[model samples]
Target: MTTRVRDDTWVWALAGLALGLFGLGFVVRWQCTRGACALGRHEWLFDLDAVGSLPRLFTTSLFLAATVVAVRVAARSAGRRRLWWAAIAVVGVGLVFAKLVSAHSVVEGLDGRGLTLLVGTVATVVGLPVLARLGRAWGVPGARAVVLSLAVYAVAALGLDQVTGLAAGLDPSPLPDAAATFVEELGEALAALGVLAVVVRRLPHPAER
Candidate 1:
């Protein structure tokens, strides 16, 4: 028999981690009025600011709770079709979070930068499941491709911002703060992908059971 674990467990854990880290960012924002100086002074607080409150924190929390239930229900569905739904939910929420944290000054309206972000968001929504499916079939290289794609997106977004003079980035060397935000979002996405990879690696395939 295949060893099947609860999908809700994984979903809830991911949601909780996301919420905690997002909440911590909000805390850090509050504490660091003078840019990152306060944060540097209270470096220990980094533990707390790991994930500051996610955008529309209350709504996101409710959605996450619902996600837990959805994953549980999907796990028991006829063909596990709910997996696609769960994947979409994860990607959609991730895109929303990215939109929220990204520097908007570069792409405030429905212009060039905004269009680029929209296209990237759509690509992410489509790419995640494809990446997952590929990972299961091709292993590490497939996962690496997904990560590299994300990094590329980050770089492209920063480049667009620079060309259009949208926002500042955090890169000390050359990129502005807005570009830095894109890199940061990319980092978070990579981290999320890592967690998903671990979960997929541990869970037994449906046929194995």
Candidate 2:
């Protein structure tokens, strides 16, 4: 396919919408627990709200946005094929992962070995296919490189979380810490990759290959 380069208004719009929805989610979560549930008032608006934190919001938004971008990029780089199913898988699994991991602090009266196992299983089943679909969209040639870049991003996010934790003295325990770290890192990575993919495609390819 001949690569095309131009500013896709939809891409920017999608990014803005994703970020806005994320901020909205935070407000909703804050209001829900504080007002409706009567969980006692806490500073969430500016205090990074324990509801999910910046990392979670950033990562999740990136993930969703990346999925949409991936479908489009796949169509351009590969071919114009319906990648909605892949989008669904990626988005669905991500939601499940967030829900499962968030249960500990976000939900009450729900903590057991079996339950964690079940949630993990569901997330795995869903996430695997989602990743696989993303790979397909990326195509065999570039899939490994994309995934590797994403992995590196995830690790960097973890490092960032650690730094943030040290400065803020947030929860140090492994489970919650790791979960939040993963969410943020993965999300940022996906969004970044989506941008990079578009930029790279737009650039003129070398004549040799």
Q: Considering every candidate listed, which one attains the maximal lDDT?
A: 2
Tens digits of per-residue lDDT, candidate 2, 68-136, equal 555444454433223533443354345435532554333323653345445545654565456656667
Model 2 segments more than 4 A misplaced: 8-42, 52-58, 71-92, 95-141, 168-209
TM per candidate: 0.32, 0.39
Q: What C-alpha lDDT values do all the predictions have? A: 0.45, 0.46
TM-score of 1: 0.32
Candidate 1 lDDT tens digits, 1-209: 44555555755665566556545554454345335545574543442212333423433343344345335434643343445435534743664464444434334554756576666666656775575665455433234443444445445544544453434333343324323443443344334434343334433345632
Candidate 2 total steric clashes: 1
Off by over 4 Å in 1: 1-5, 35-40, 47-166, 169-209
Lowest summed lDDT window (length 10), candidate 1: 47-56
Write down the RMSD of all candidates, one decimal each.
12.8, 9.1
TM-score: model 2 vs. ground truth: 0.39
